[model samples]
Target: MAQESKPVAQVDVRNIGGIDEASVTLPEGVSILTGRNATNRTSFLQALMAGLGSRQSSLKGDAEKGEVTLVLDDETYTRTLQRRGDSVSFDGDPYLDDPELADLFAFLLENNEARQAVARGDDLREIIMRPIDIDSIEAEIRECKREREELESEIEKLDSLERDLSDLETDRREKVESLEAAREELESVNDELDELDTGIEESQTRKQELENAFQRVRDARSKLDNIEFDLETERSTLSELKAEREELHETIENAEKPDENADRLAGRIDELRGRKRSLDDDINELGSVINFNEDLIDGSGIEIYEGTPSDDPTDALNADGQTVCWTCGSEVGTDQIEATLDRLRELRSDKLDERSEIRAKIQELTDQQSSIREAEREIERAQERLTAVETEIESTESRIADLEDQIESKQEEIEELEQDAESIDVEGYDESIKLHREANEIELRIERFKDEIEEIDDEIDKREAAIERREELKSEREELASRLTELRTRVDRIEETAVEEFNEHMETVLEILEYENLDRIWIERRETEVREGRRKVTRTRFELHIVRSSSDGTAYEDTVDHLSESEREVTGLVFALAGYLVHDVYETVPFVLLDSLEAIDSDRIARVVDYFRTHADYLVTALLPEDANALPEEYAYTESID
Candidate 1:
């Protein structure tokens, strides 16, 4: 079968770290990136590493949005990093390669174990052995140990449950005994309640009879109360009748004779009435005279005679010259008419005074007559009232007698009912009530005992279920323990195989690099006890040791710590390369990236580069211009960055 070329053919970077946009086409064999410090050469290599599946990249600052595209022999792969997220995609097959291996073998950047091992004061064993999957083996062992611990925990739980099962059985026995006792006590109570059932029933029947008698008493009492109320009403009616009769009798006595003062006033009024009639006639005559005189004085009622009157007092001498009186048809002098008119006026004034007095006397007589009439009417009414009172008094007395008889009869009935009620035997009723209450209490006790027994049964079921679960867990624990042992054995076998391969490859690489004073290099599996706080931990690890031949031609084994800086650096590098080769990392990734190898001299760097070229299908290195220039011209395809 023909060997396949490396997957990465070209890398195009945009907005990654210090590089805004750059594209570098990778050639076959070794390639070197030549740039001064801070020239973004490391960024370019990191992009390749990222495209090959490394997470070390800046997604902020100058490289806020970055993308690295890798041109493969038959396809293209691209990785993008944005502020939100990152993604890797491919046009053909997905980049199924492990990104962790890329960090392990693909990059020799600062702080990488391969580069730091030279200057670090820590043991070189861990540094040399880092590239292999020993940590993965240790992790597997830890997982097995964790599984074993879990099995042990389950076994402990099972043991505890088994121990608890004994106690649960003991408790169950006690509960059974308690349940039995309670059931026996409840049965005895139920028997006692059953024996009292007949007595309770008989007492209940008797209680009903007594209740009926008591109800009869209550009814009789209610009837008696109604009778008493009726008697009281009748008595009140009789008293009212007597009171009305007495008042009527007094009124009749007082009205027996009319008012004497009225009679006397009537006699006086009769005399004054006769005088008043005479005076009224006089007043009328006086009024007529006064009117006549007034008319005569004015000469309104007198006919005028056909004569003229003289101014003199005695001027009337003949009928033609005299004035004639209209009533008498006689001639009269003015002096004579004046004298008659004056006399008539005086008479009328006197008659008016007498008439006023008569009218006063008549009015007094009329008032007396009215008083006499009112007294007669009162006397008649009193006599009628006295008759009515007499009739009501007889009727009320009859009703009162009837009410008294009815009340006495109701009282006798109520007394007989009360005596009968008192004769009913209440003792049997009370005894029945107490027996029923006791029966109810016994029933409750029986129910409580039943419930307790049920609870005990439930507890027993729960304990039995727990014991069954413990058995299942015991079986599971056994299976887990078997798996844990198998895993541990497998881990041991894999460790032996990996350690042997790593030592063989390191020996070969050390020889090829021409490391002086090194006879052989190998890795040894070591176990040490360490105390971390309160815990004593057994730590298993692989340590790197080298056999150095002294000037006396004798070989002795020593650790990597006694080696020089360049030797250590070379040893770490070769160890990493050996792990890569031994584990077939190159078969999948087929690439290694190296940068900042200033700790090793130029000549040694060329040898390391040459070793990498033979081992990896594709190798990329970042170095300063001078370092790039020192590499063999044909082996390095140099790329420069300004």
Candidate 2:
């Protein structure tokens, strides 16, 4: 039974197809439009499709423009079709942002590619996979990979920084303890100096002079040590820079030259791109022609057009019962048209394959070009680095020479100061001299400890800052990991889900329909290598295999050609349903429009509708009176549209 509380989706049509003006409200669940062939049922459906963002609708023959307005979810969406010379242009916001998915899956009409592909023995896999843009997905995956790599690198650096935190803290603690101990020793030495007796003032003066000389000698020696350390550090750096320069020279010499064929590859890629554009134009034209013809043959009467001549009307069918070709007004059999459409379809498929091959060739050539560019850049970088390293070596050597001269001058000053301290006349003031030397040494120790502690504090601050950044880097890396996983599995997930849905639904439908001796009708997704241009590439193919039980109860394989029209139609619908589910179209559009189920018997049609109804919020189907009667009376039914 239809849910009374379910929200209604309202549609208003004006000058669309044969519908001049009409408004329809579709409730949730099944809504059957029970009418004869030309009661504007398909036109209403087309109008509804236009409102849903499908470009498959047409303007009325008598009107230059048409519009369809859809009101659902308390929101209004409008689509306008304007006739321009020979072609129609569409404008206005519609229900969907991109209608490709809805057109291929949600809008199930008589001439729909999904439905017709099976009838015409077309590539079912291609039709099902058409809505997916593989190139975009692959490009996104590549981008995700790059981001993940960068995140990983940053995280690694953070991890290394975190490992050094403990050592930094320990070093800071040791420096602080040493600073405290040195301050205590200096305090003790100052107390002892204050406790020294004031007797022998002259001796104290001589001791002070000797103390000054000793202090000068200590300062000179400390300066000399620092200069010598600087000289040694500069000498080490110079050696390293010289080694690096030699390595850079060797790398530059051994670097391979960039490929000379890059220009040729670029030209070839450009040519292929041009060919692809041409193929796109050709494919689009053929698709338009096929759709127009299919529309004409399926329902839209030629007499609906204002300029077309229809004197006898019956003359539209020749003596041989052939349709008058709309393009040339020549008598052409429907079979011939179908055959022509098949050829065009095959040609389009071939062009697509050719385009794929060309794309692969372009990618290959582009990769080669990238390699060549990288090689050239590497050699240039090596040469530049070599020159910089040579300059650094010269600078370092000069610095080392300056430091050595400073060290020699400081050492000579230290020796002269030490000799002066030793020559001091401190025979009676030896004790005073000893006290002064001890205090001076303690002060120097305190200064050295303070400097070391400051350096450790700076290092500790840096390490703590780096540790704080580690958490943020970890969070970013986790996000990148999730994105990478999603990107890597998107295509495979869709493929698997599509196959699973199709097989599961097919099994259930076959059971419900109770086809005699039919064991199974399942689609197997397989990959096989096929020659595309000069190269062989792996491509996915959907193999529809049928198993039937013979009279002896032994099951055997059967081909698609052996299937009846009703079976093919049902199979195609199931395939379309699989795509609809796989793409999650229900989230995008609420309505699933079904039309032209004339081939299936009424009972089977009812079962099929019943099967499909549960999958959608609203299942609007067009059916003949008899077929409509087979459905449950609980479904919403409309006999005529005004």
Candidate 3:
């Protein structure tokens, strides 16, 4: 698509940061960048276009020597544009190598010239009159949207790692308490056993003393019986002597009454007296035993009485001592009686002492016997107690055994518990395990969250990129659409002017000094777009008439090729005059560039300059020194390039 009449005018070069470079201002309106011809003016021209990188010709310049900038009507795009060994680059964009943007860039340099130059043949001229996209802003927005999608996905993974650590710590604490409780129970059982052992030792010592006391009592009882038997025999001898004294006294009285033999009577009397004495002594020998039976019974409070004995009393305690009837009146001797009495007294005393001694012994032994019996009873009880204690000890041992078995079983259970508790790692290991588990869970959640966010972000990035790209496409569409409208307007104008008829009229109007007519002077456009390709507006050029040189009558489409040198220059000047009719200017700057125009007559150049001054404010030309006088005074500004 073609921009109306705004042609690129001038460029200003500035050393912006001002680091050792010179700056200069180029003029608008047909400035000739002039110096000596070989003094770098052409290279300066190359430098001018180098500021717009693709504006350089097929031959571009060196980049490393300097940086450049171009000022356009909208904004300035600056770059270090240059060529490096057959490659063109602008701000590191490979200008010559890129076909799309580069082609559009190259079009600016060529299209700025006249369209007749394109019809006459210029390489990049045909493309620059068209636009690719209306604006470049849409391309930048797509780049930003894609970058945002990648950043959000990384944050989600960190959250899941924190949760798993909490659960593992709780299980480890319970097992330690159970082991402590078992230890306390065992301490209690050991204390109970200690107390029971002390009681059993004390009971055994007391039982031994009881057994010794029972044996001592039995020995004392046997000794008291033997001593009592000796005293009883001695008292019985004294009692028989008292009975003989009574018989002797009775015989002595009966013999005195019989008077038969006096000598025999004397002898019998002596015998009877002696016998009586003996009997008396014998009777007295029993001493107080016979008589003391009553006294002893009365004085000692015994149960025996004085009476004739019938055999011996069976229950006598003092049977070794005898009883006598001392109060029975009978003849007896005094000396013998005294002796018997003395002996009897001795026996009675012995019997009494023996009875008292034996009785005392018996009483003492009886107490001892009772103590012995009690001791025996105690021993029996102790035996029973010892038996019971042994049974208790056995039972306690059995209980201890059972406890041990239980402990063993509990130990096995503890082992099993320990095995199960392996899952509950104590000693701070549980905390680590729990933390790892929490971390793993958090990691999984974070990964899933990241995946979800990434999917959404990627989709959004792609959609935004597509939208931005569509906006660019829409800008191109708008450019193409506007071009279609402009092309349609141009077609309508041409058709309304009756292009075929206009061509005929234009031929007549241009009949002076011209050699050959253009092959295609009238333009036709096809405004329809191709759906899939560059649907740029198109124009067709046509020439319904030909021009000829008046001298040779030779014909050519481009007057520059076939006409005489002056004819060619006059025709080009005529074309420049016709362009003044077509172009509009608020402050008119009518300009042209003509190569090899030295063949034109000075009179014709004067006419062209006068024609320009009538309609324009500024007219500038590039020429050799001889061409300066061809313009009227002040009608044109003249600049010469060698």
Counting clashing residue pairs in each candidate, in order, gives: 0, 0, 34
Compose the digit string of candidate 1's lDDT tens values, residues 20-123: 78888887788888755545676677677778876554432333477878877767888876754333222222243555555555566643544444334344
Best by TM-score: 2
Candidates' lDDT values, in order?
0.62, 0.78, 0.36
Question: Candidate 2 or 3, higher lDDT?
Answer: 2
Candidate 2: the clashing residue pairs are none
TM-score of 1: 0.40
Cα error, residue 631 of model 2, in Å, equals 2.1
Give model 3's clash tally. 34
**How high is the lDDT of residue 237 in model 2?**
90
Stretches off by above 4 angstroms in model 2 are 1-6, 61-63, 119-202, 230-288, 298-302, 305-405, 415-486, 530-539, 640-642
lDDT of 1: 0.62
Model 1 off-target regions past 4 Å?
Answer: 35-38, 59-63, 83-98, 114-486, 518-521, 531-537, 546-562, 625-636
